[model samples]
Target: MAEWINVKDIADGAKFYAGAAIRIMPTPCGLEEGNFIPENGLVYLISDNASDKSYFNCVCLSAGEEGNVICRLERKGNYVLGSEIKRMFESELQEAFISKSIEIAVI
Candidate 1:
């Protein structure tokens, strides 16, 4: 498996290669490898070292009275709206839907 490193952990002036990918997650929560993109996170294909990488998307959940549900949404290109993840989290009651424990390291 390709190593998945947290962007926050990357040192300044770190190097990258063409065709490499960056996982654009709405939140800082980690994602497991081999899962669908947007289902957990969005993947940005690096066009080159010159490709700009920045995203400010967010997830809006329905009110608690609505059972913390996510409103239906349309897919945006290759990315799944964060609403779907919120729905998965709510449906699973957050039990291992994301992760049950915090990870101090990335692989």
Candidate 2:
């Protein structure tokens, strides 16, 4: 049998790193440069699931922050939703990362 692992440990593995925290500065949905709501924001991380190797999408989800905008990409069934994946890219629009997941392997 496979080694049993705690969900917290598994979730902790998926970290969504952002440039800055939402609490540091409060900005509107547009021209904010990050995808996460302050206080109750979504975790955001940049993955290589973009068309090009330089661009990435910001995933959202309903999870608390372990720190900053990084959280575990909650896996459900056999698929994971963008919202559950705590990771966002540097953008001014919050909807830019909507319905998209980084196709790059999590290093």
Candidate 3:
């Protein structure tokens, strides 16, 4: 099973690569990472560098790791709608998701 995590929680000060699988919660304005628990349905991917105190730059999740995910992106070659990341500058949006399988360093 996969886990839902808050980027802010795991972002301990390391860089999250693009295409990382993650679960996120839907908001009135947009979607946001929910928590730091593993769950199924990898429905989001990190689209850009996300710091511990920053918002996510992600898209809908897909199969495989970063390499595989990148291939999927190349095949699709189009922007995913309704999957845009929000609250980039807000310091109150406490939501993030990351896979426990992936190794992360604590700072």
Candidate 4:
């Protein structure tokens, strides 16, 4: 059984969003200087099953803070309408995240 991490645990601002939670592909590096590799795991909901998967998206504001990493929405935050995922704005992503609709992974 895989563990489900609450968004509120790592990013303090995520509980405000709705859909919720993610499994991790753990990494041991710092996400700084625009350095991120998507080879790591995605922020996906186990409840959402489809031919094309949906994943939460976030921009790391600060990763140096222990236990409480800071993040905002990605410019193209993961937005799904019906079976299609769309490219949305960062603030829109923030809304989704704040409403507890999304969860972020630890870097």
| TM-scores for all predictions | 0.33, 0.24, 0.33, 0.20
lDDT values for all models:
0.32, 0.33, 0.39, 0.31
The digit string of per-residue lDDT tens for model 2 on 45-92 reads: 433333433333333333454323232333343334334433422334
Task: Please identify which of the two predictions, 2 or 3, would achieve the higher lDDT against the true structure.
Answer: 3
Candidate 3 residue lDDT tens string, 1-107: 55545655543333444545555434333324553223433355555433422333445433453222211221112222112222241234233455533333456
Stretches of candidate 4 above 4 Å error? 1-18, 29-38, 46-99, 103-107
Clash count for each candidate, listed in order shown: 0, 10, 16, 11
RMSD in Å for candidate 3, one decimal? Answer: 12.1
Question: Cα deviation in Å at residue 63, candidate 4?
Answer: 25
RMSD to true structure for each model, in Å: 15.2, 14.3, 12.1, 13.8
Model 4 superposed RMSD (Cα):
13.8
Ranking by lDDT: 3, 2, 1, 4
Best model per lDDT? 3
Prediction 1 global C-alpha lDDT? 0.32
- Model 3: lDDT equals 0.39
Show pairs that collide, candidate 1: none
What would the per-residue lDDT of candidate 4 be over residues 18-102, giving only the tens digit for each residue?
A: 2433333323342332323243433433232233343433323223322332232221234332211212312211211122244
* TM-score of model number 2: 0.24
